[model samples]
Target: MIWPPTRPAPDPVRPGEESVWDYPRPPRLEAVRARLRVVLGDAVIAETEAGFRVLETSHPPTYYLPPGDIAAGTLVNPRRGGICEWKGQARLFDVQGGGKAASGAAWTYPDPTPDFRAIAGYVAFYAGPMDACFVGPDRATPQPGTFYGGWITPGIVGPFKGAPGTMGW
Candidate 1:
């Protein structure tokens, strides 16, 4: 049988690094032991090690923190939501922490698609809405462009999705 071609080389990243270009088409959910934290205003609104990450080509990981790790009563009803073709429907939440409030700062899939069952009822925050989001010690950069919420950190390389002229990707 003929061998399937290997993926073309990604832009060079240092050892022990990840390239978003090499991530798969359908996206992969991987368990992470890294200490993930989300801070808004002066509060650590959420933190967890028992978290999962969604990795898709040309995108940084959008971390889903278990609702248990989030501060009590931080996420409240706001009647907002959106649809994800892959993950199914998402319900948006307003977060108030450390005396700050950002509407639609967090979202969850109450019933995700079969492939993303691990994150059902789990919430992911928009890095832009928070003061900072951390994977280990590095604070994350919000993914470029208005619509996407992937978190960019130092070790993840990307030309990335969500930029102008990249909608086709």
Candidate 2:
């Protein structure tokens, strides 16, 4: 593995599309107005139009919804946490709703670094574990890999990180 390895060529972007390769390296947090929804089993556990997304090079956006927009009794903080160089510490949450539960499927930064302070206490879900996740009306696929929580929507293109052999990137 090489440090500062060359990035793979990004997929061709059609009109009105976004290439993840064009995103910044340290990542950028941006407010989003499109409706974001997370469904588990038969329940819609989270929905919001006032969410935010973190975009980084070689990755699709990771959407964060306000805690107020999530259903009551759906998130259980389990004391598991992780550190991100860009976002600071993140506390993990188990998602329990719609007759199902997924452990560590969600996370939040109770006290985020200043760059991401706007999303403090907001939660981001791993779309792969949910029955469905949507950005606007488009169903989102989970970004490839076990670790990253990016949601791949229709308009986002990538040769994203997280696949095997990309860790060095």
Candidate 3:
């Protein structure tokens, strides 16, 4: 059963609290794939119908796709792993495309909960780790550090709560 019929309304921003209500909703199924183009150096990774998902975080946007669609051959198995309260445990991978590729860059929830079945077996990339990540028709250089992905567009206003110290806001 879907937990909430619709996402809960963001909490009200109190005085001195960082406002993050303007954050964009997860990209629609079509929008995410339309703007994605995978490349390995000069070679274009085949464009296929890969799954995509946006995790809720204060940082940039996170894009998820099936391992079959990604050039997994270039990924180096990493020893790090993490768990998500809403999803499940994640196994990390380091991109090994020479020194240009992002290291320890991707992660996957091999066995997510039923609600997150769409993301199961799919790998998600940190937009910050990629050289280029796009949303819709806009192409953006990934932000530095560990950002999720940003969906900021004209008329979009967001402070997206949960950055470094703004967790309780």
Candidate 2 wrong stretches, greater than 4 Å = 1-4
What TM-score does structure 3 among the candidates reach?
0.64
* Per-residue lDDT over 1-169 for candidate 3, one digit per residue giving the tens place of the 0 to 100 score: 3433333355565554432354334322222555454444444332345556453434344566667777647567765578766667888877654246666777788888776778877776655555544555555444333434343332222444434434443
What is candidate 1's lDDT per residue for 58-151, written digit by digit as tens? 8899999998998898899846488988899899999989999998888999999999999998999999989999999999999988778899
**Where is model 1 more than 4 Å wrong at Cα?**
1-10
Rank the models by lDDT, top first.
2, 1, 3
Instruction: At residue 47, give the lDDT of candidate 2.
Output: 98
Task: Give the per-residue lDDT digits (tens) of candidate 2, residues 1-169.
Answer: 6768777888999999999999998999999999999999889999999999999999899999999999999998667589999999999999999789998999999999999999999999999999999999999999999899999988899888989888767
TM-score of each: 0.91, 0.96, 0.64
Tell me the whole-model lDDT of each prediction, alpha carbons only: 0.88, 0.93, 0.53
The predicted structure with the larger lDDT, 2 or 3, is 2
Q: What's the true lDDT of residue 156 in model 3?
A: 29
lDDT accuracy of residue 163 in candidate 3: 44
